[model samples]
Target: MATIQFRLRSKANKNVSIKVRLSIDRNNVFELNTGFSINPKDWSETNNLPKQTTPENKLLSSDLKKLDSYIIENLNTDLGKSILIDSNWLESKINDCFSRVVKTDTSLLINHIQHIIDNANTRKVKNKIGLSASTIKNYTLFRNIISEYQKKIKKQIQFIEITKPFVDKFTNWLINTKNYSTNYAGKQLEILKTVCIDAEKNEIQVAPYSKIIQHFRESEKDRYIQTLSFEELELILNVDLSNIEQLNQFKKENPELTKNLSITPESLNNVRNWILLGCEIGQRGGDLLEITRENIRYNGKNYYIDLIQQKTNKSVTIGIIAPHVIDIVENNLPKKIPHQKLNEYAKVICKLAGIVEVVKGTKLNTETNRKELGNYPKYELIASHCFRRSFASNYYKKIPTPILINITGHSKESLFLTYINKREDKDANADLFMQFYEKLNKDKEPQLKIIKSGTND
Candidate 1:
């Protein structure tokens, strides 16, 4: 049997380094660095350990004992019995022992990320619903991008290696090499930070990269949130789908024009009603697409939308107060519509409604594989999310913020305010603020009093 003993190396500048010595049958000896140095006076030759019982010394003693036990445990294994008991074998065992016991090899940055992704694949959010398909897709994409980043750098990194410099280099690679937008790159970094935080909870050291993620900022141009005005909503509602059938007939007669105008009357009517419903209820596309006749509830006098939001898993009741919503609920309404198709038809509906106001927005230029900001027609910016924002923005002051937030599932007041305030029409925002300013000043005007800087004046 091999006996492990703690010993001190030669003292230099009053500091003595500790080493573990393994004696095999009291003949051959092997020394391993404990990677700890202490004051010469703190070493106790009699006890063969540190002299004091301070917290630091106690931890060091515990580590030394753990390392000693690890070696002994391995020596008793079947593989250990087959190998020759010599200094060379003991030295190799030391490396294997640290790798197994201390997790020095398996705790690489990429490995921890893969573990997080694998665990996320099986994670449930509201105890029943698993992670959304899009979420899983994004995580997989992020993992692939990280792997590519590692390949580009030609080295594997540890968790502790994630620092500001690493973030900077990775961000630049995402923007330049991968052609990701600033907002998208920031989102990827946010996901990476989230994974790093999870790794930290599992006792992984990641403090070096925690603060670096906060510095990532998406440009203001990239932060535009599209919303429809009441006029634009009315225009879409009033669009004549009767001509859509004629257009389809025309497309059949002329095949070349089919690509430009390939809409049908039924599809147009379906998306129009869906958009009207979404604008009235202010629900996300996930919940909007799931709506059915079963979701409508009547409380004797009034009707309400009673459904649990799919994204948040929170039950919300939206009163059927809007005239258009009431009409749709009382009349014929589609049981379900594809969310992607709804978004596509919504843009076409907006365009036909003459909602062509120029606005700044980001678009992925497929030719260059990069996101560039340019002036696009207002209809091009219209999406399913715009319906929710339109509801919030149009009725921000008409309804109580708390009540709206309850329906929207926004947890924070500040975030809700920010969401509603992101308007493309500057004049509309100014008008809302002006109304607030007028209301405040209407009650009482401030009486001005002037005082000279010098009392003599």
Candidate 2:
């Protein structure tokens, strides 16, 4: 068993800092230096003296010695370093550590991550992978890719001692053999790098994954994932809410509401409200879902949604009541639910509203044939992130791009511009038709005035 020892370091100013050192031996060690903090109100330096001064300290006496003996017996290994610590030994050590310092079960990545993930089945992992899903998924893929490559190449190398060259070969295999996107292969390589970091912390110096600079194809300029036309956008906006069929359906399905439009409609008013909530607020899924009734209120006469963004950790006080968005908000008090449930609800609602493709990137316009577009009319590629993308897309087209970027908390224009969809030529033609109509009706009656926009008056 490795011991975690603590020590005091007194600086030149006579200020003391605590240092924690972890060591499997006197030779190999890692340390954490904690700086000083302000003293708490109730703690007294003199009053805490007796335990330090006398034999009254029971911690250094019996309990620590007993613990030391128990740990020594457990670690009575006349063993040499073998291939990555065997499962039984690793699990026992981790379990022992968990029992001793129970607060942080994941202090050591190798102990907690590898032992658990290596032994568990997919079902067990699916149930228990906490904030660790993204990490494990990549390593598991790397492991598979390596295994497959080894069989074909008849590599004279063991995977545990896999070198940088091997990693390069594996990455190439993932791209060429697996038919994976280079971007995805790059992501897996990055994840492999992290796993190597974890391995380093455990003193298992995995040869650097590779030395190759990551190469990615330039993303196409007009290869926008979103292609909503001006008419489609208008159809979404000018939907007749008082439709008798919707009312009848609402009466039948009292607790839930559904839409009838072929395109994405603002069905389930509350969920649509949340979708619009994401649109105007321009936050990641978690941040947008954190909005509550209190965070929204009239500041004199203007409405605002004020909440901390989840990913950026920055305060966002934007209006969800923007003219482009407000109609979806249901006028009522708010309710609280767990973040997970709310996120799940957002997913369900996004799909039900015909916005699923845009949310998941499961499908894209460029990927589909135009001839097949009608059958898959609602086949737009959407993702949970598409809310932020759509918000940026529309705002970039209608407003200043820089202002849109700032409002959405994007730090770079080029990175953000990728989210902006291209203008469809079909929509440009529609606007041209509108101009022609206006020209033809130059000397017309009030019937020519079907307003698609609001008047300042």
Candidate 3:
């Protein structure tokens, strides 16, 4: 029979470290650190246990008893005697008892991430049965990044090693070495924290230091968002793409540029209409490109674009408020174009529409393959996402936020506000506040009156 006992290292009035003694007969004996401490006043010399007068003493005694039973049960098993018995082995058993470390392969950080990726489709979010395709893609990318980081450190990340300093090092590496934006690094760290939180929910033990791990604050430069204004949208909507003969003539003259682009007049025309539709509907590019004539529905008095959003699986009915948009939806809904084509052609179309205002934003450098911040023509930054943001920004105060949330599929107002760069629109918001202030005080009389400095008026 194997026996386990806990005792203080040295008797003292102050806190003293506790040690574990394990005996397998008289021939084999082992001592291990218990990672616990207590004062001599709380000890019971006769029983070799803490006195049960205080709650702390009771818990310590209870944990020591559990450790004793746990060790004896394991040592009595055939599996335990097959391996070598040493101080290190006894220390491992003590760690297991206290949950100071995870001993299972399933609890490894990389292995757990693989498990999460494999089961992503079956996992539920809100009311949906699976994560969005984009979300899964991002998770796969983050997994690759974590693998590279592990290689850099020459260590496999353990769930118990995800502490504040570990996350800080990872984030700094992402920003400094990987050339990732602060917000991008923060988002990746958030995903890592999410995995840890999910692991904890499944009864996995992580390091106590992980509780202090937090996301990096978004940098001001990264927080700057660029969206198409109403003027830009109108310019795109009314662009002169009807002159196919002139477009063909220009393409004929610029064969070197047009050869690879395959920019037909019809393609440009289709992209133009798609951009307008996206601005009006405020849906994601994936869902926006799928809109066809069939999505239009008549509600007796008004026409609506009814469809289920692909990412959220939530149905939204966009009421056709603008007469021009309603005209296009009812009669001239453009043929579906490739989402990539929309992204590429959108820049060309906007550039042709004379949207060349210099703006501060991030754009991909082809050589580096990373988005770098610089001043660029607004048209260069225009993409499918710009349309949704444009719709949100253009109609922010004109329409209620909740109604916009329904259309844009955003879960909350704060996220939507942040998405549209509300913090950067202080001047416009100030004008709106001034308008409301005047309206509230329209009929009120002035309270202040001029008086001499020496006189009590």
C-alpha lDDT of candidate 2 relative to the true structure: 0.49
Query: What is the TM-score (0 to 1) of candidate 3?
Result: 0.71
Candidate 3 regions off by >4 Å?
1-102, 217-222, 248-259, 424-457
Root-mean-square deviation of each candidate, in angstroms?
Answer: 13.5, 21.9, 13.1
Candidate 2's residue-wise lDDT over 1-457, tens digit each? 5774444433233434434344566664655432221122212234321133335343333333443444345555524433332334433453464353322324332243454356434423324423344345655665666456657887533224446666767777877776666566777666555555555555553445322325454265414354333343444344444465754553455332222222223333444455555655667766666666667767576777677654444566676545655444436322444444444344434433343232223233344321121222232343346567667766664655556766777667666765564434457546766877898998877666566667676
- Taken over the whole model, the C-alpha lDDT of each candidate is 0.76, 0.49, 0.82
What TM-score would candidate 1 get against the native?
0.67
Count steric clashes of candidate 3: 0
Per residue, candidate 3 scores C-alpha lDDT tens digits across 299-354 of 79998888989877889999987877887777678887778777878887887788
> In terms of lDDT, which candidate is strongest?
3
**Number of clashes in every candidate structure?**
0, 10, 0
Query: Model 1 lDDT vs. the true structure?
Result: 0.76
lDDT of 3: 0.82
**Candidate 1 C-alpha lDDT tens digits along 1-457:** 6678888876556877788788766566778776567776777788778876688888777777777887788777734568766655666676675553333654576787677667765765657546666677778888888888889999876777778888888888888888887767888888888777777778887756563575364544447767888888899889787785665664576453234443777767888888888898999987888888898988898989988876556789999887887889989575576676677678777876788899987655768977677888887778888999999988886776678899898877777877765424457556877887898899796799997788774
Which candidate number maximizes TM-score?
Answer: 3
lDDT winner, 1 or 3: 3
TM-scores, all models, native as reference: 0.67, 0.45, 0.71
